[model samples]
Target: MSRPEVLCIGALLWDVIGRAPRRMAPGADVPGRIRHVPGGVALNVAVALARRGLAAALLSAVGRDPEGDALLAEARRLGVLTGWIVRDTGLPTDCYMAVEDSAGLIAAIADAHSLEQAGAAILAPLDDLPAWTGPVVLDGNLTEDLLAAIAADPRLAAADLRVVPASPGKAERLEPLIAARRGCFYLNRLEAEILAHRACPDAASAAEAVVARGAARVLVTDGANPAADAIAGGPTLAVPPPRVTIARVTGAGDCFLAAHLAAGLAGQPREAALRAAVEAAAAHVAGRDLP
Candidate 1:
C-alpha cells in the first residue's frame, strides 16, 4: 500500500445507533432500527476520506480483543491504513451509542475510557511529526491536556492540521488549538457557540464568533440551514445545503469535514469547497452513502 496522505487521530470504535420513526420524548419507547458499525470521529472521517479515494491512516487506539481485531480488519478492508493504530492489550475496544429519531439525534453516550486511558500513547507513531508533512484530522475526543501538548509541539508546525470536536459536549476541549491559532476547525453551530461561549443564531454568526476567538479558520454548519466558512481576519462565506429528508445524523459532520478536505485537495475553490461539504453532509443525513 502507498503511504497515507492524511492522518486521522482520535476515537476508533463500534457505533450502536437506535433510530425511531418519530420524535422521541423523555422515557418514550418506540420501535426503531438498531445496527452496529465502525464509527468514531477520526474513524468516520477516515472512512469517508477513503471512500473518496484518499489514502487515510488512523492514529488512535483499539484493544487486542476480538472486537478490536474485527474493527481493524474492517478498517483495512475499507482502505484505511491501520498500521499506525495502537493496540492496547490491557484495554478493551471503545464504543459509542446514540439514539436518534425522525427529528434527529436525541441522546448518546461514549464509552471511550480505554482510549482516554491510552492517551498520548496513540501518538507514539508520530514522534517525528516534522518529517511528515501531510493533512491531519485531529478529533476532540482526546483529553484536553493531550490536545494542549500537541498544540505546543513545534514539530506539528509543518503539517496541514484540521481539528474537529467529537461532539458539542467536547467542543470546549479545543480551546488550546483556538488560542494557538493552530488549525482549521470543523464545527456545528452548537459546538461553535460552546467554544466561543456565546449564542449564535446562525452558522454565519457562529463562524464569525469562532474566528473572532482566534481560530485560524472555522466552518460552522446548522442543521438543514446554511453552513458558513470563516477565516480569521478574512472572508466569511455561507452556503445553504440541499433540502433532503432527515435520516441518520451520526457522522454527518465528519462527512462534511472529509468532503471539504477532499474538495480542497482536489483544487476546488473556497466557495466550491463549502458547497461540496454542505451537499455531502446533506446526502449523508439523507441516508446516502459516501461516494
Candidate 2:
C-alpha cells in the first residue's frame, strides 16, 4: 500500500545533548560528552514516522550552510522528503542545546530564532506542492499569526490535519486551530492547561478543559496517565506507559506524536493509538529500542 504524506512544519537542525548519570545544580559543573544529532519537533517526528515505514516530509526552513546541507542529506537518506524545506541563504539552521540527567530534563534553551524570525515565508513552498495531499503535523514553534492563518487556510481543509503545541510556552498558538475547528489538538496536561488557562489535575480533565475551549478532539497526555477525549463520534480511552529509568526528554513528545499519527492512520482505534504513542515515548526517553 502507498503511504500518505506527513508534513512536519517547524525548525529543523542539530541537537547538542549532554548526558549525565546524576542531576546537576546551579554552578555545579558536570562531566558529560556532547553529541550532535538530528533534532527538532518536526524533524524528530519525521524520523519517528520514517521509523514506522511511513511517508513523511519536512515543510520548514533550513540554512544554506553546511549544517543545513548535512541535515538535509541525512533526512533524505532516512526516506523523509526535504524538497519542501526552504533554504535561506542568510539564515542559519536553528538548534537546541540541553543538559539531561538521570531524572529527566532540568533546564534547557531553544535557539530557534531563525525559525521564529522567518515567519510565514517558511510555508510558501507548500503552496505549490501537488503530492502533499495528506495530513500535516503542524508544530507550535511557529508564530501565532502564521498558525492562525493556517487555521483558516481552506487549501488544507481538504486533508486531515493534526496540530500539536510544541510545549507549554507556545500552547496558545494552538488556540486558533481550536477556534476555527481546523484540527485535532495533541497536548500534554500542562500544555492543555496553558491553552485553556485552567488548572487541570489529569489528562482527561485537561482534555475536557481544552474541549471546552471549542476543540473538537483533544489528546491529553500526562507523563503516565494517558487519556484521550474525542468528539468525532469516537470513544475515549485511558492508557498507561511502562516505567523506566529516564535518559532524555527533549524529543520524547515528538516521538509520541509520530507514533500516534501512524497508529491512527493505520485504522487502529483510539485506545490502540494512545497506547502506541505512550509506548513509543517511553521507549524514547528510556533509550530503549524504538517502539
Candidate 3:
C-alpha cells in the first residue's frame, strides 16, 4: 500500500441534510429535499482530498453497525484509506443533521458522542510511530483533552498539522492547538471570533487575530464575502470567492481546506493556493463536486 499523503482524524458519520428552496422562518413547515450522504469534518476532507488525487487516510472511530460498514465501504470506493479506523462495538455510528434554506443553514445537530467516547483509542496508531512527518488534518470534534494531548505529543512534533473546528460551537475547543502554535487552523469568521474572544468583522481581521493568538497559520472564510490566509507574522492574503447561488453549505469549508492542501502539496505559491481553495469552495457551494 502507498503511504498516505495526509491523515484525517475525527468523526466519520452520515450527514442528513434537509434543504429548502426558499428562506425559512422558525416553526414554518415548508417543502424541501432531504438526503443522506457520508459526511463529517474528517470524512468530508478525506473525500475531497481523494477527489484531488491525494492519498488520504482516516484515523477515526466508527461503529460496527450497518451504517459504519457502509460508510467504510464508501470511503474505500472514494479512494480514502480506512485501515486505521477503529470499529467500536460499544457505540453506533455517529450522524449530523442540518436544515438549510436559500439564505443559509438554519440549524444543525451533531451526534458524535461515540468519537468523544473513543477518546485516545482512535490515536493509538501514533503511539507506535516514533514521529510522523506527513500532514495531518485534525477535526475539532474531538474532546478538548484529546486535542491538547495530540498538540503536545512528541510523536507528531515534526508533522504538518492542520486543524479545523467542526463548527462554531466547537470553535473554543481548538484553543489548545492555538496555544501550542503547532497547527494551521481553518475556520470561518465566526469561529475565529469565538476563539479570539473578540469581534472580527472580516476574514482578514479574523485571520490576523488567530495568528496573533499563536497559530502557525490560519485560514478564515466569510460566506460570499472574502476569505483570508495568513502565516504567523505575515501579511494576510484575502481573496473573494465566486458569488454563486447557494446549493448547500454543509461541506463547503472542508472542500476548501482539501483543495488548499492539495494545492500546497503540489507546490503552489501562497496566493495561488488560497485562490484555488476559494474557487473550489465556490464550486462546492454551487452544488458541484470537488473534482
Candidate 4:
C-alpha cells in the first residue's frame, strides 16, 4: 500500500513517422524511411519512467482495436502500470502521423478527438483508491470542459500535478488550471504564447508570463534555445540545451519533462534535473536511445 510513483494521464497512441535527410517541398519525389513506434505523452512518460526504474501508471482512454491490443502488450513489455486505462468499445484507437526533415518536423496530424468525448472514465478509479499520492502529469488534449472538471475534482487535487499542453491547438484548454493555480506547467514557447496570448521571445519570458497567469509554477522550453523554470514563489531559472543535430521533433518535449521528473524524484537538485532533462531530450532528438 505504498503510493504510486507517478500517474501519466493523456493520449496513448500509435505514432507513424516518416523521415528524410533533405528538406522537403511540395510535389517532389523523395526517398525517406518510415518508422512506426509507440508514442503519446502518457505512453512516452510511462515508458521513460519505467526505463528509469520507477513505478508509473497510465490513465487514458484507449480503444479495443488491434492497435490498442498491441499498445497494451507493449506497455506491459515496458513495465508501465495499465490497470487504470479506460477501454472504449465503440471508438477506434488514437493515432498520430508526422513527416520530419533533418531540420525538424515539417508536418503532423493527430486523431485524438474521440478521447475527448470519452470524458473522465479513465480517472474514475482514482476516487476509489485507498492510497493514491505522487505526481500526476496532465495533458491539454482533453476538452476544456473536462479540464475544468479536473481542476475542480477532488480525486486529482491531492496529487502533485504536472501539467503539459498537448499541442498548440489545445493549449488554451489549460486556462482552467491557470485560473485555479493548481499545477506546475510544462510548455514550449509557442504553447506558452497560446495560453498567455502574447508573444514570448524565449522560454524565460514564457515561464514568467505563466507565473503571471496564476499558475503555481512553470517550465517553459524553446526548442534549441534556453529552457526556463519558475517556482510558485521562487526566482526564474534558465538553462540552454546542449548542442545537438535535429533529427526529429516528435515527443522530445515529453522526454524532457519526464526526465526532469525522474531526476527530481531521484533527489537531484533543480539544476541537475534541468541538465538531465536537456541531455535526455537531446538524445531523443538525435534519434538515439534516451540516456
What do the candidate models score in CA lDDT, each in turn?
A: 0.90, 0.79, 0.91, 0.84
| Model 3 ranges off by over 4 Å | 128-130
What are the C-alpha RMSDs, in order, of all predicted structures? Answer: 1.5, 2.5, 1.4, 1.9
How many clashes would you count in candidate 3? 0
Predicted structure with the largest lDDT when compared to the true one: 3
lDDT of 1: 0.90
List model 4 lDDT by residue over 1-291, tens digit each.
234589888888889999888988866568998888888887888888888998888888878888899988888898888888788637888898988888888878888865776887777868767544588888876778888888888777677788898788779989998998888898989998888789988898888887988988888888889998887678888989888888788999899889999998889988889888888888899878623
TM-score of 1: 0.97
lDDT of 1 by residue, 223-273 (tens): 988999999777899999999988899999999999999999999999999
Q: lDDT tens string, model 2, 1-291?
A: 134377788868788888788988867788876678888888888888998988887878778888988989988887787876777637788888888877777667777777877787777766676634587888888888888887667666566777887768788877788888778788888898898798988887788777777888888878756556555445556787788788777788888889998998899977888889888888888888522
Model 1 clashing residue pairs (backbone): none
In candidate 4, which residue ranges exceed 4 Å CA deviation?
1-3
- Candidate 4 matches the true fold with a TM-score of 0.95
Q: What would the per-residue lDDT of candidate 3 be over residues 211-256, giving only the tens digit for each residue?
A: 8888889999999999999888678899999999998999999999
TM-score of each: 0.97, 0.92, 0.97, 0.95
Model 1: residues with Cα > 4 Å off, grouped in runs: 128-130
Ranking by lDDT: 3, 1, 4, 2
